[model samples]
Target chain A: MEFGPHLLLATLEGLVQASVLTLTALGLSLVFGVMRVVNVAHGEFYMLGAVLAWFVTSMIGGSAAIGFMAALIIAPLLVGLLAALADWLVLRRIDYDPERTIVATIGLLYIIQQVTLMTYGPDAHPVAPPFNTRLALPWFEFTDGGLSMYWPWGLSTTSYKLFVIAAAIVTLLALWMLMAKSKLGLILRATQLDGETAQAFGIPVEKVYALVFGMGAALAALGAVLVVPIQQAHYLMGDDPLLLSFIVVIIGGLGSLRGTVVAAILIGMSDGIISVFFTPTLAKILATLLVAMVLVYRPNGLFGAKPA
Target chain B: MKSKTLLSAAPTRRNVLTGLAAAGAATALPNFARYAHAGSDAPIKIGFQVHRTGIGAAYGRWYERTTNAAAKVINDAGGINGRPIGIVAEDDGTDPKRGAEVLEKFANQHGCDIAYGTLFSHVVIGSAPRAAELKLPYFVVSEGHHVASGMLNRYTLQPGITDVKSQVQAMAPFVADNLGKKVTMIYPDFAFGHNHRDFFSEAIAAQGGEVIAKLAIPPTETSFTKYFPQIPRETEVIYHVMVGPSVLTFVKELGEFFGPSHPEIFGFIDSLEAVDFASPGLEFLEGTHFWEGMPRYAQSNQTDADKFYRAAIGIDDKGASLDDPKDVSTYAHMFGCWETLYTIKDGMEASGYKGPADRQSLIEAVEAITDMPEGREHPQGAKLFNGKTHQVFGPQYISKVEGGKLVVQHTTSIEDGLYPDEVDYTAQSF
Candidate 1:
């Protein structure tokens, strides 16, 4: 009822949104950073992840916890493999031409969407969280003897939501470490720096591209699996995530991973808070306008490198 | 005597050519020739404009199934006017622009006498003008009040399914008396949603209840927790009706936000139409009530007509297929398509329709229908068609979710929903 509790609840909701957005946008950013390709179907990949999560969970009948755990481990791997296969079959055939790849990915979007629709049907499905504990949050008030914590009546959040935030933080840290301190990351960075030179030095450029593409999609799938319990899996659910990921990628700098994470946080928080306070349409309007302003002022994005 | 002599004396080339042309024209027109009955034996074509690939695709799939099943029965039962009924289906993709194009295809390309089976309100609103322009005699199964509101032309009719105005009017009394006085409606933000907002507001007011908060959510929204905080704390009942592809999320999130401590929830079956109630996240809805246009689970007092319809559609008493429990039918809304096809057959028979030339007569005949009693012709319920508004009034069912099945608890009579005529389609002329 009070402003502080409402604001805190809004912030918690925003954090969950930001966590998913960060993972999804990071994938979009990574693909562009190393591959210099705009995957218009990135959102479809996100959707496919959710659908696959539902499928995998349904196939392996058990308690909700086992199903969800299996989905967490398996859905992203399966999605990543599929993305890699698509890269090899479709993107490789096009030679990854920048303009043509955009069109190709758009086609892939529809193909993937229709396939899911045919297989999964046109209904929204809900996945149960592994655990859902209603935890009442406490608000602190200044009393005669320092500050004391009191139970905030009607102001609480679920444990699953908090878990989402923590999980995202852990995932982000792991991703950062993988990109910054691993051999695969080294080859990936080399390809990003100079594909021709990397190929000449036997970096296996094509394979790296395939790997990056798969990893990018897998990251999106990972986000989807995390959020599917909170949201429903529908064939058309990918559009928003795709749009927001592109917005985050653009504003953060198209090829800047760190920038992408920062931008996702900003957009996700604002979207959640604004949507709660005002209207979802207005929140989207403001985000789009923000993108326009960013493009006008800093076209390279916040952390994008200066062109040589 | 002079004209007869002149006509009879003609064995000339001009006379021969004129006679041959007249014979060809008569054969083509069906009703003009002395051999008209022979030519009229050809199948009567009805265009089914279906939303096979968009937001309404779920409903469209079931509507198509119902249409085919009804057509098969009609054709087997000696057909209408002793001619087989043929359904020429075109996918509208659930987009308005595509819906209009489908209607044009029906009129000009397919030569169908009528176009029917559009479900979503926007598509109906979008395609109705084109139907008017083409004089296609559009029969929409959508629940929107657009037809009764007099926004569309006279050629369009909704004589099988009850409109949103009538449905909400019938529901308001039950919601006020049984549920609570202060209501908050969370509906899809579109024309259909607007109808619920406007009509329910007025209807509830007449029942001495007030709508405390109205939340209009975008139909495409994926998540809904952020929207729940906006419901005023004093709200006593949460009235929700969500459509499109994400209804499961809409319901599940509401449950999560409330967690068994929220207001009494009453939802339209739209939110759970295709969803299995036993699905894990939906257990929170065990005791809540939902408004069903037609009860999903067959009742103990189920009519012979409803049983026949279910068997024909391969659905069991639980509204799922005999094969798979997950393959649930949209029982609430799809009966409109079945009933509408029968109505079209009745109209065609009443008009003595022989061909395209009798299209106007068909429209007039349909307008002439005053009552449709519940039977094999209408499995949903009995309906009273108002020729003035081109809308039907029917009984609405309130079903409670018990043990993962929707059980019918109340059925409102047709008169409870009737209101003053908004517009007379008959007065506007065909």
Candidate 2:
């Protein structure tokens, strides 16, 4: 009801948005950065994650906790495997040329979307949250004696939403560790630096490319599985996430994971807050304008390495 | 598969007689004896302009199934005018340009005697002009107010189902009286949603209620919690009518945003048409009410006619297949396609239609249809065909979710949904 509570509610919403956006853009950034492949079907992978979540939950047939936990683990693995298969079958055949890959992934987008439609049917199905306990946030008011905490009406949020934020942080940290600390990370970084040199050194550069591609898609699926409880899974749900991820990735700098995370937060927070305070249409217009300004001022993006 | 086999294996004489009986013929059945000789061996081609691959694809699937089932019944019992009825289906892709293109294909290429089975309002609005220009009798099952409002020509008729204007008008009073006076509407930002936004406001206003906040979300929006914050805190009833592929999200998000302590909710069943009520996270909707064109879950008082039709189409009492519960049918809107085909049959027989030359006679014959009683042919419910406006007026059901099943709580009479004639289609020259 008061300014502080409303702002807090808005911030909470923004945090949820930022969390999902980070995972989605991370996937897009990883693919482009490591594999040099622009996967236009990244959003479809996100949708597939949600659909697969629904399928897994339905098949498991138990309480929300069990189903959700299964989905969190299984959906991403399945999506990553599917993405790797797609790369092996289609992208490898075309040799992963930038222009051809874009067109091919677009085709993949439609193929995945249509297949999901045919199999899943065009109905939106909801996945229940494992837990959704509402905890009313207390707002402090300065009185004559001292500051007193009062529970603000309509300022409460579900525990499940908070869990989503927490889960995303853990996932992002784990991803960073994998990229920075592991042997696979060294090979991937080497390939990203110079694919021909890495290949000459017997790093199995092609295998790294496939792994990166799968990892990227798996991150998207992870995001989708987390958010699917809050959102329904449908065939056409991929388009918006796709557009938003592209916007975040471009602003963050293509292939720049750090930049991608930063841009996703910026865009997601602004989107949530502005859509609440003003209108959803205005938020979208402002985001698009920000993209244009970023392109004009910094062509390579905020975290992008300078071109050779 | 089991349901289909069981239905097919049932006694043919019983099915045919029950079907004829279910087609509540308050008006006399057409004397097809004379017209039977006109095309004894020919097949009468009816073009089905279906939305097989877009936002309306879910509805399109059920619409196609209903159309096929109806055609099968018609052919089983001596087809229209003794000639076997054939459906020539063209997928409009649910795009406006594609809709017009499909209409042209139907008239110029397919040589269909009539164009039928369009459900999406936008597609119907887009393709109507082309149908008029081509002089093809277009029978739309869409619920948009365009046809009754005289925006379309005489060739385009919506004689099977009521439009949004009439539906909202009937539903508003029940929503206002039983629910709350201060309503907040959350709808998809499109012509169909606009119809709800406008008509519901007007209807509620007439009942001394006011719509406090109106939130129009992009149809493609996946998440909806951001939009929920826009609804003013003072809002009483939340009126939602969301469409597209992400309706489950729209509903689940609302529940999450206001767990157990939100405003009373009234939604168009379009939001959950193909969705299972027992699905996880939908328990919040247990007591909420939805406006249905036709009651999805069969009520205890369901007529024998409705039961017979459900069996005829292989749908269970739950509005899904007895064979597979997950393959749920769009129970509300698909009935329009089945009933529309029957109207076409009755109109053709009444007009003694021989071929395309008798198109005008066919239009006049349909306009002559004043009443459709509750029977096999009019299984959705009894409807009054306004020969003047070329739209049907039918009963609208308001159902409440109880124990994860939709229980019909109120049934508004056909007269409750009627308005003064918007335009006289018969006055408009062919």
Candidate 3:
């Protein structure tokens, strides 16, 4: 069937949604990139961010507008601190075994999710969208490539979606600048490139590693804050996105930030479209097959560098 | 030990200080939180293998609240057979494996007179054999029929009628009487939806109608816009066989169609409960009909039994009498657990002197019951056991969505349907 306006709308939604995915995947890729810790529990961090965002917003935001911004800003930072704490308490003394670490994180994931559930209770907390209306697809063209016909005869984009896309772009750009342009960025790269060498240079590589993990935690929270408007904050909501991020990281080549971004948009679009056609179960089957094919055929993803 | 003696909670401080002001309740009353052994001085412990956490948590939270409240009301009236109902609640978390675990714990560890309640059909089905195995009287408030009927070891009994045939019974008669049309079925491709498709077609055909078209969609298909045209325009009714967010999405898309010049749509009333049919503006569902065997508490069900329902539920401090059937249905469904405890008490009374209320004897008493002690006294009401499959069947009611609420206005008379025994519900087109 030919892709209709709904399809276009779905794709636009997917892209903005992909921004959140890429943001989280970037953090996941960073963790895997440096420590070689599989971080199977990366999604739990995202869930923690969402849960924190939900509770804090419930306390802070008297209204939807205030809640939206407060959650977006504070959720990630708060989660970052929490992530650092988790590292201190658990991961700091964890076994160096990769599979064991993965298994431990998985355990941590369930424990964290269950604890959140026990606290917040299991009902889905609704986070209202910042924008009031859909900017129709047949209106003015957006710089972000979404045609807002839900708008009047002319409007660049639906303000809400445009804000999300802008946020995503700003997040990616800020991450790039932080990694490439800042002193912390330099330390991170140095540690990632050669941990023992960086330590020999008296760089305090342990501090760098901890900080990098915290930043990863912040990104996961940021992703949750952005996602609240679309899906509403739920405990299990992070699982799907978490699995997708794993796919993106693996597809982009583990530890590759740019690779994750490219892979996210493609994966998001495929998932969004296929899910519209089939049930989520079927879409998952297709996604699994796609990931398997990529692993077999490409070995590394399209933009991924060959493994050592 | 997540609160040992989980059958019921430690009574709230409010209930403890201010004893229930019993209003014309009989000697055989229910003992809620206070005075567990008031009835026979021998504690009648009823076990509840319920969902406290997990996916079913949404329903489970309300279920526990209402059931516990009902037990409180029953206690206020009088303890069952002069024995206060001691409840041991266990959290199954809506998992079948977990349900079995809790059922085992409930029967063996807690030594319950009967296992009272479960929400999910899968949980009910999984726990039925165990109920028969340990011979614990398992009372269910689910839509599935397989939990009862089929070669029952006289332990499990559903208070509600079968879902598939009952769903068809509610709609097909309405279709034949009102519209004189057979509907095109667009169901989710699953055992649940397929059961509806197979039965509804036969039900519709039995009424001088032929099935026009049938299309199966994915189980969780949210978008149904493109697939709208897949059902030929020739069909009169577009019966949606889906639930949850999928139903909401499907209806929203169907609202966009504005075709068949008032296309008749049909489905289960359970779908109505999950959805906010009022907003997202389902004026599209206006004048639409669906099957609802369980009537609203106060509006339709105004019998002596309903007094307990009204008192137990509808406690809005805003001073509005709770008429919302959704809330009351949740209350009543859980109330079945309350009544089920009393039924076990009746069985114990019939079985003569009980030591600790053995599981095998309790199940035997439940199976041997000609009618549930608390079952409908009306000729055309829900029958607890019909001696055929040791299951329950009730009159089905048709609900119409009017002015943002699904109110059960009309009800179907009695029908002879020995589902679990005469028909293998599982073997049907799933």
Query: What C-alpha lDDT values do all the predictions have?
Result: 0.88, 0.88, 0.64
Once fitted onto the true fold, the runs of candidate 3 whose alpha carbons sit more than 4 angstroms away are A1-17, A60-62, A95-100, A132-170, A200-202, A297-301, B1-40, B148-153, B160-162, B175-194, B205-267, B272-307, B317-335, B353-384, B400-403, B416-430
TM-score (all chains, Cα) for each model: 0.91, 0.90, 0.78
Sort by TM-score, best first: what order?
1, 2, 3
Name the best candidate (by DockQ): 2
On TM-score, who's better, 2 or 3? 2
> What does candidate 3 score on TM?
0.78
Report the Cα lDDT for candidate 1. 0.88
Q: What is the DockQ of each candidate?
A: 0.33, 0.40, 0.15
Model 2, range B75-179, lDDT digits (tens) per residue?
999999988988888888788889999989878876779999998788888999999899999999989899988889999999888999999999999998899
Q: Is candidate 1 or 2 superior in DockQ?
A: 2
> Which 10 consecutive residues of model 2 chain A have the lowest summed lDDT?
A149-158
Sequence-dependent TM-score of model 1: 0.91
- Backbone clashes for every candidate come to 0, 6, 26
